[model samples]
Target: MITKYKLYFLTLVVSLLLLGCASKQNFIDKSKSITKETYTYHTFENKNKLQLDFYQSINYKNTKPLILYVHGGGFSGGARDENYIKNYCSKMAKNGFAVASISYRLTMKKLGFGCNTEASLKKEAFIKASEDISYATKYLIDNKKKFNIDTTKIILVGSSAGAEAILNLAYVYENKILAKEFKYAGVIAMAGAITSIEKISTKRAIPTLLFHGTKDKLVPYNVAPHHYCKKNKKGYLQLYGSKAIANKLKELNTSYNLYTIQNGNHSWNSKPMFVYFREMISFIDHQVLQSKYQQKEVVKKISDYTSTDL
Candidate 1:
C-alpha cells in the first residue's frame, strides 16, 4: 500500500538502475567486437620465447596508437594470453588503439633463496623484463608499417610485477643507450613501483598514469622494500611506489596522474576490466595524445635554466 508519490519515486530509482545495467552491457558488447592478431615477437638464445597479441578495431581508419601491455604474476607467472589481459586489450583496441599484450621471462625458479640471493634474482628479473619490453617496442617500431602503429603514440601498461617492469622500462631502461631509438608517449602502472626515485630524471620523464590501492601489501602504495621485506632482510630491494614516484615527478614539473583506490587490493584485474580501462583511455587521450608537454620543449627549458643560473 504505497502512496502515489512514493510509487513514483520507486519507479524512477528502478528506471535509473535499469539504464545503468543497459549501459554496462552495451560497453561489454562493444569490447567483444574487436579483432585480434597474434605474432611471435621475440626469442632469446636460452630458448625462452616471448610473443605479442595485437588487438585493433575493425573500423580503425588511421595509424592506431600503441599500448604495450605487460602481465603480472609476481615476476614469475602469467602470460600474454591470459583471458583477462586479452579482454582488456581488446577493449582498448575497440577504442581505436592497437593493443599489444607481451610475454617476458619469469624468475619463480630462483625464489626460495635467502635475502641477498633473492634480492639479486629479483633485480635480474626486473632487468630482464625491462629488456624484453624494450625489444618488444623495437619490434613494433621496426615493423610499424605492418602493424599500422603510430610510432609517436606508444604507451606502456603493466599490472603488479608487470607494472614494476614497465615503470623500470619507462624510467630506468629508457635512460640507457639501449633505448635510444624508442620514444614513449606515456606509461600506465597498475599496482606498480620503481627501484628508486633517483632513476627518474627530469629530462627523461614521460607522462605517467598510476593506479594503486592504498592497502596493497605486495607492492607498497608508498615506499617499501620489494615484496615488503624487512629492512634488515638479506634480499630487501628498495622500491618506491606510485605516491613517491608522483611526488618526485611533481618536483620535476612533469605531467602525471595518480589514482589512489581507497581500500583497494592488488587484484585490480579481477574486477571488471572496463572500469579502469575507461579511465586509462581518458588518460591516454588527454595526457599522451593531446598533451602539450613536448620533449624538445622540456630539453630547451632545462638548457635555458642551466644557462641562466650559470
Candidate 2:
C-alpha cells in the first residue's frame, strides 16, 4: 500500500543496510584468518624469561610493516597475551601487518608503584622496560629476513606505563643498548609521557600518534608529576605527557597527531585500539611508511564517544 517512490526509497535503505552488514562480515572473516606465533626472545642473567607473541595474516607478504606493542601495568603486572591485546594485534594482522606483543620485566612488582615508591625506582622501571623493548626490536631485526618483514617500518605502540617507556626511548633516552644506527620508525603512545620533554629534538622527531584523556589521573595530559605526587613525596617525578610532547613536535615542525579526549580517563589506553583502528592504520601508512607531514589535533568529549562508532 505504498507509493512507487516511497517503495524505491525503502528498497535503497534496505540495500545499504545489507551492504554494511556484508562488509562487516567480510572483515570478520579476514580477522579469523590471522595467525599467531610465540617466541622466547630473551633471557635475563637471573634466568628469568621474556617472550613475544607475533601475529600475522595467513597470507602475509614480504616487506610488510611491523607493530611492536608493549602492555601497560605500571611496571607491576600485565601480560602480553591479554585478550584485549590479542584482539588488537589480530586486527592489525588482518590488515596485512605483523604485530609483536612483548613481555618485559616487572621491576616494580614486589615494591608497589605508588607515591611511596622512589622516583629513582620509577626511572629504573622505565629504563628496564625500554631495554626489554630494545632487545625485542633487535631480535625482530635480526630475523627480519626470516619473517619477511621490513625492519625499517617497525612502529612502537604502548599504553600507560608502557607508553612512558616507549616515548622515553623514542626521545628522552639514548638507546646505547641497541645498534647505534637503529631507530624506531614511529610511536603510538596511549596516555604516555616522557621524563624530559627538552630531550625531544629534530633528530629524534618521528611520526607520532598520541591518544590521551585530559582527565587522566595517572599520566598527565600536560606537564605534571608522576601519579600527581606532591613535591615533598618520594615518587614526585615530573612528566611531559601527550599535550606537551605534541606541542614539542609542533615546535619542531614534525609529523604528529594528538587525539585529545575531554573528560576521558585512562581507559582510553585500550579504546583507541578498538575505536580508532583506522586512524592508527592511516598513520602507519601515510606518516610512518611514507613521508606525510600532518600535525592534526582531534578533540572529542566523552559524551559524544561510543564504542560502536569509529
Candidate 3:
C-alpha cells in the first residue's frame, strides 16, 4: 500500500510539470500576436471626465514597436478606431507593432461647431484635442516597463484632420504646444495639412511620409485661398496636392517622401493597404532621425543672403 501511494504522488507531480510546460508554450505563441489588443482612454467633455474608446494592439512579445493613431473627422467628429483604420491597425500590430486608435473633440459643425465668434475658443478646443492624443501616448510610454516596450521608438500616424494634429505635435513641440511627453521616430500622414503652411514650409521635425489624391475635395490639394474647400473652382486647397507640396518640400530640402495616388480620394485604403503599411513599418525599423534636406530653390532666400555676404 505504501508503494502504491508513492507512485500516485509521483504521477501527479509529472502531470503538473507538463501543464506548466504547456502554459509556457502558450505564452510564446501569444507573443506573436501583439496587435490584437484594443483599449479605451478617458478624457473630459465640458469639464466632466468621460471614457473614449480606442483600439490598442496587444503586445504579446513585449517587443513590438508602437504607432499611435489619431483618426480624422475634419477636426470635429470621428471615432478613434474607425473601421477604416481598424483592419490596417490590426495588420500592423499583428506584424509587430502596438497600435492605438484615438478619439478627439470635434468642431462646432461636427454636430456642434457653434456660431460663437470666438475663433480662439474653437482653436482652444482643437488644442485640447491634441492634448488628449499626447496624453494617451504618454500613458503608453509610462507603462512601457509593464508592457516590455521600447518607449523611445514610436511612430505617429493620422489622416486628414488627425494628420493635422500629428503634424502640429511634431513641429509645435518646440513651441510647447502639444504632446510634450512623447518621442516620435517618423510620421505617416494621409491627406494632412498644417494649420500654418508658412510655419511648416519654414521648419519641420521628423521625416514625414505623405499620401494624397489629386481629386481630393475635402482638405484641398493646396493651402487656403486655393484649398479644395469649395467644389465650385476646386478652390484653394489644391495647393496641398502631393506634387505641389512635394515641390515645396524639395525647395525646403526636408527629408520627406510622397506617393501620390492617381485621382486617389482623400484617404485611399484599398490597394494593399496592409502591404503599404508593412513596407513603411520596415522603413521605420531602420531609419534614424536626421536633418531634413533643404532644396536650393526653397531655401534660396537664406542661401542667397549668405552668398551675397560671401
Candidate 4:
C-alpha cells in the first residue's frame, strides 16, 4: 500500500540504523576486555577528589598484575586522566595486565598552599605528592581482594614529577620502617629523577626501569653538565650509551636498565614510550625480584633468564 519512493526511503532508514548499531558493536568488541571503569574513591563535590580508573584484563589471568600510573604535570597542573594515559592503559589492559590511572592530591592542596607558593616550593611539594601516592597504594592494598589483585605484585609507574612520588614510595615501603602497609612488585619511571639515591641503603632490591629522551629539553638527560659522571650513572648513558649504564649496573651489582632515545621529544608519545613499556612488561613477566633471603629459591631461575643478563 506504499508508494515506491516511500518504500525506498524506509529501506534506507533501516540500513542506516543497522550501520549505526554495527559501528557501536565494533567499538564494544575492541574495548570489551579493556575495562574503562572510573571508580570514584572520594567525592569532593567539585573540589579535589582522589579517583581511580581501572583497566581490566581480557584473557590469560585467574589473577592479574596491576600497573598504577601517576601522571606528570609537575604535581600541580595535571590529573590522572591528563596526557591521555587511558589509551595506553587500554592497550596494556587488553594485553592482560590490569591498569590503573590514579588521581592524587595536588601538592598545593596537600600543603594548603594553593596559588601561594610562587617560588617553586619543590621539597615540600614532593613530600606531599608522595604521601598522596602512598594513600593510593594503601587504597589498593586494602581492597586487594575486591580488585582481584595480587597484593604482592603492584607496580608503581610514574612520569615526570610523579617520578618523585615513585622514588619516595620505594624508599619508604622498604623495612616496613615507615608505617609500611603495602608491598610492590616493581617500579617504572618515565622521565623520572632518582631522588635520594644516597638515602637508599636498604637491601630490599626492587627492579627499576628508567626511560628518558636524550634530546629532552625539559628534565635534561643529564642533570648538570658537570654533575654527570660523579653522581648519575643513568645520566652518563645519554652521552655514552646503554652499555655505559649497563656496565655501571654490573659494577654496582644492581639490576636496572636505562634506554635513551636518540632525538626523542620530551612530551611526545613516540616509539620510545612503547619500547619502554615493552621492556617493563618483559621484566614483570619474568618476575625479576627475588628477596635477598630467597637466593636459594631463584638461583637456578636466574640462570634461566640468560636473555636479560648473559
Clashes of 1: 2
After aligning candidate 2 to the native by TM-score, how far in Å is the CA of 253 from where it should be?
0.6
Better of 1 and 4 by TM-score: 1
Native-referenced Cα lDDT, model 3: 0.53
Q: Which prediction has more favorable lDDT, 3 or 4?
A: 4
Candidate 3, residues 1-310, lDDT tens digits: the string is 5453244334434533543443222433443444344444554556744233333344244454567877777666777655556665655554445666766656544333333224354455556666777777766776777555566667788777776677666654343422445457778777765545445554464566666655666555455422323434321222233355556666676666676655656654233244255346434543422233422211112122232222
Scored against the true structure, residue 147 in model 3 reaches a CA lDDT of 52
Please identify which of the two predictions, 1 or 2, would achieve the higher TM-score against the true structure. 2
Tens-digit per-residue lDDT, 88-192, candidate 4: 676566555677888876765444322233323555566666766666666776777777776676787887767656765675323332245445667776665
lDDT of residue 65 for candidate 4: 65
> Per-residue lDDT of 117-191 in model 2, one digit per residue for the tens?
999999999999988999899999899987778887789999998899999889977787788988889999999
**TM-score of every candidate:** 0.81, 0.90, 0.65, 0.66
Show where candidate 4 strays beyond 4 Å: 1-29, 42-48, 58-61, 108-120, 172-182, 225-251, 268-271, 287-310
What's the number of clashes in each of the models?
2, 0, 32, 0
Q: In lDDT terms, how accurate is model 4?
A: 0.55
CA lDDT, every model vs. true structure: 0.73, 0.85, 0.53, 0.55
lDDT by residue (40-61, candidate 1, tens digit) is 7787788777788888876665
lDDT of model 1 at residue 192? Answer: 90
